[model samples]
Target: MTASVANDDGPQGLRRGAVGFGGVLFQSITFMAPAIATALSIPLGISYAGGATPLAVILALVACLIAANSIGQLSTHLPSAGSFYTFVSHGIHPKVGFLVAWGFLLGVIVGGPFLALQMGFVVAGTLNAEWGWSNDTWWIWTVLVCVLVFALGYRGITASTRAGLVLGAFEILVFVGISVTLIFQAGSDNTLQVFGTHYANNPDYQGFSGVIAASVFTILAFIGFEQAAPIAEEAHEPRRTVPRAILVSCLAIGAFYILNTYASAVAFGPAKMIGFTADDSNPWQNILARDAWGGIGFLLVFLALVNSIIANQNAANNSSTRTMFAMGRIRLLPPEFGRLNPFGSPMLALCAQLAVSLAVALFLGFHYDPVTGFGLTATILVDIFAPMYILLNVACLMYFWRFRRDEFNVVRHGVLPILGALAFVPAFFAGAGIPAFSFITALPKPLWYAGPIAGIWMVIGVIYLIVLNGRDPDRILETKRVFDEA
Candidate 1:
């Protein structure tokens, strides 16, 4: 199980056996960043779905579970750092895999800024908690965090995953405790009222139509859970660990979201909901967090949110660095990225990712406010990820349908994959076009050109492939080496 056995002059091997099931689960779960998800996304979704936020989240979770099952099914068959990149190349078409890889890259790239901004927000709030080092310019904080995040990535997978495990546990504990306290405070109001049509007090909401509309945001929050698959090659017992991590993490995130959102809705009862969600500030801080378990509750929320952002950026970098290394090693792109450091980390690729994130964060910081920048960039991520998941589902279906027919189960291989793809239909429609299902209405006028942007991104990848093929006529066959040789 030599993960990479290139000659000394070429790519140095990645350190395998660094992440086990717990490592994958904690890293992926933190990437989901339940505290941040519940803090920001849930309230925004609640704005659309009204009091039925729990139901919208539940529907999104069901769709995510279906998609995750398909990914898990394929991880056992095509375990690699390339994740969907390797899967699609082998099962669909190698050219199509190129599109998925860069699309994924761009998506993960923006996440760094998003996570940095989140860290900045939490740090800003924590000033009153006897914390110092409050920067007037939040991008300063973004820069500082990026340095720390890159240092963590530079340390390689085991250090990053272990850090994620500790940070994730603390954040999850705070969020879960807050949820329970919020629900307990709800007392008589905590009945299954959130499941009912009791949102007349909610602003601009239209019953069931609104809840259905909000599922897009709910689904967006589930995007990070699948990052587990890309680490399959590095994880110990990846064939077993990757699939388990994907499934369990998805379920855990869903349950937490439902409980957390329910508690929020109950905590901010119908009368206060309208005024509370109307403001542009952090709703968690404005509404429930400050008063949480007393005044110091804000500190707990702040700590969890900050920890979540750091852990999430580390996890995102882990996935991106590995994917870049995978693409480079397969000869689909330049091999320099595949060349690792003495410590076995894809150091050059990690550096590239950090530089891009900083540049983009700087540009957006100057051009737009953090909220709009975050919203628009996050929409791109959601849009890009939809296709990655869709392709992986197709790859899983085809992998079983053609190559290993004996191992194929109708539901696991065929029906589940098909269902998973279908579940994302609304996401495609929401992202691509149609005025009805706009996922995030909050972003400023420079809207996310989800389909056009994705199409252009693919076109660029295809052009690169054409050039690579011209340089080495055997590029396609060489790229398929892992699929055939493995």
Candidate 2:
């Protein structure tokens, strides 16, 4: 038997073995942006799930873990910088892989401006609230953070992941500490009832229906757990490291999410938790922080938001740029995007991504305000991401069943992947306002455009794939040839 050639030592020149287990772990952790998710995304569950928000988080965790299992299994054999694109191309067909790559890039591309708008909004708002700084200067902060992320990413994967390690660790500690303190301070208010259907008091969506509805938002919070797969080509012993990073990050952050949601419910008094999103600003977390440690806790939480955005964007850029580089290398995109800087980083792809993200963010920020623009980008992200995830799960099942049949287990490849794909179905329909899911209720205006935009993008990708095949069929053929042989 022959050993497979490691992806890290490939011809891509992306600094092989530059990132270790810890670095790989934090890449996914920071990308998930646990602090931001806890402060913002988690509370969306409360509005629907009411006091049973923790139950929603647990359901989401299970769904994400199932999907992560499929992703981890694929990464073990096809650890390419293309990540999902690589997996799908080799596992399924190259044409479908091209579409997945295109759609996945659309999701990741918008993620940049999404987090940039968030950073600017959070920093500028915090300063205004605390020190009377002008919140109007958000665009300035947004640009600065984009530049910082670009610099870190350009320096190389090692530098960016190391930065993520520090930023990710601090944000996690601050949120975990505040959550524990809130739980303790709740005293008699803290109860396991928050995890039960009895406390699901939302009039519009209560009991199991509420939990299912809220899991949509909770699942979005777990979006970046598979980010480690993109950096696999740079990871030390990627076959082992990448799989561990994806699974562990999902489990760790899932637990972190559960704790934070429980504490938020208890601290705010479960009966009134349904009103957590009453204020568009969602000030409950900040109020809890201030009550716990006075001014210092408030300051730390604010800083954590800032840190989370920076770290999150940094990790996101690593994934997007590398995937772009991978596509470019295969001639699915222009060759320039495949080029690297002297530092062995995909500088061209990085520059192109930041330029586009910054422009989009600034236009949306000035046009509709930062918060609104942020929501728009986030909605678009979820629309693009949900389908891509379902596709990946399908690819995993196909890969093992058709190619590696002898090693395939019915439970791992068949049942888990089917369940993983099914889990996203309700969330996707609800998010897109399919009307079939009556429990979805009213959605924000941004979602109205998001679904259409994602559809247009997919149509465009299909057109492009057709043209690419006509012009140069070898490029698409080469995708499977490169790794399938390895």
Candidate 3:
């Protein structure tokens, strides 16, 4: 009944109100993992968008904003850890909700290792860049990070958030400062040329399709916005804090992306747009090392990359565990997953998720380089995530516009959802088929990378949902009830 921090008297055994709006906001922002995205993700986006990287970023921002608004409205009603799964269930059907939960859980469980896999190389690269010593074994770093994430998450939400906030804030400050300095140094040459239409023909692109393709990858940078929703129940005044945190993080990160992309493009100037990003993974470090505070900037950028991955993993751990914890409570998953530790953390679920993450990171580490593994995992996740977003977008319209007409409005619930759906449609289709990142050289199915994986996972979800509905209708009802709770 309290709107503050969870204590020993808490009802569900999980700590409640462990943090406020700032805690949720920082978690969401860090979840986007902007520091590394600006450093690493910019190259992929720039290579695709040609000279129009900024425009691609803008397109991605608008799309994400539209989607964020849709989920924003949904969060105002059912503030649950299942997040989109909860929203879709109440808004649509229980069966579909089960599928979303299945797919999303699958994504995040692997997402930990996916992000961690990349961080491994980031750590190795940083060591080499800073101290002039090379470590060929990146998997060692992956193991170390996995331990830290699982251990920190095991402690409690408050400890995890405080650590993430401190590291996340420093990472953002250094990256943002570097980007702003880059912009100011451009002076007259710093035109809105980054947003120009000329990129489609800039001698490097395959027409406007390149920009369209680039928008798909850059859109991933805004992903952490939704992470706030999964932790809504842990927030102080969730209804107010969750939606505000989500929208604000979404837009704020979007602005940073636009400026960051523009500045990076400016660093390469107008002529080298294609050449600058092609095959370059360390663009941010490269530019920073060339600046006045070269040595300090290099070290900070490297640390930022390292921080980005850890913070992102911690954020993902918080989200994935809570979703599983909520699932376990409702019998959607194993009862063990729902069990809380004496310290109020979802210990069993943390171990379960961490095991899967470490296993995948080690498996991929042995087979491929970090970039390829990261790209492959990210491509698969995109396929999994798109449907969740699409369903949530449509579900919001169905819930507000049709079922709860009293709460429906022309703009907030109706137009925004439709716009969000419209925006994601093309991007979803364009990306779901191929490996958008060049670094990802191969897939199990060469012709259709994500299509097969996405299809099979979805089929499995449908089968499971059907079985659960047939065998345990009461549990289905219970799951629905969880979302309906105020």
Question: In candidate 1, what are the lDDT values of residues 243-314, reduced to their tens digit?
Answer: 899999999989999988888778877545545567645667545876567666776777777887888888
**lDDT for each residue of candidate 3 in 1-486, tens digit (9 for 90 to 100):** 533223324225456677788889988888989988787775676766777888888888988988888888888888887787888888888777878888987786669888878878878876776577666668888888989999889888888888888878888888788888887887777877668666544454555666766787688777778788988877788888988988999999899888777887776675577766454458677664457257788777877888888998999889899889888878888777767776678877899888988888788667777656776777777778777888889889987876789988988788888888877665566456543443233345422456677778788878888888789877665545543224
| Top-TM-score candidate index | 2
Clashing pairs in 2: none
lDDT of 2 by residue, 1-486 (tens): 122222333335566788999999999999999999988988877788888999999999999999999999999998888888788887789888888888987876688899999988888988887789998999999999999999999898889999999999999999899889988898988799878898888887878888888888789899999999998878888999999999999999999999988988888788888887676464644687887787898888888888999999999999999988888777777777777776678867999888988998999899989999998888888787788789889999999999999989999999999999999887777656666676765556764777788889899988888888999888776666433223
TM-score of 3: 0.92
Compare the candidates by lDDT and give the number of the best one.
Answer: 2
> What pairs collide in candidate 3?
6-16
> The CA-based lDDT of model 3 is what?
0.77
Local error of candidate 2 at residue 312 (angstroms): 0.4
Ranking by lDDT: 2, 3, 1
* Clash totals, every prediction: 0, 0, 1
Candidate 1 deviant stretches above 4 angstroms: 1-7, 125-135, 196-205, 270-276, 436-444, 448-453, 469-473, 477-486
Candidate 1 weakest lDDT stretch, 10 residues: 477-486
Per-residue error at 312 for model 1, in Å?
Answer: 0.7
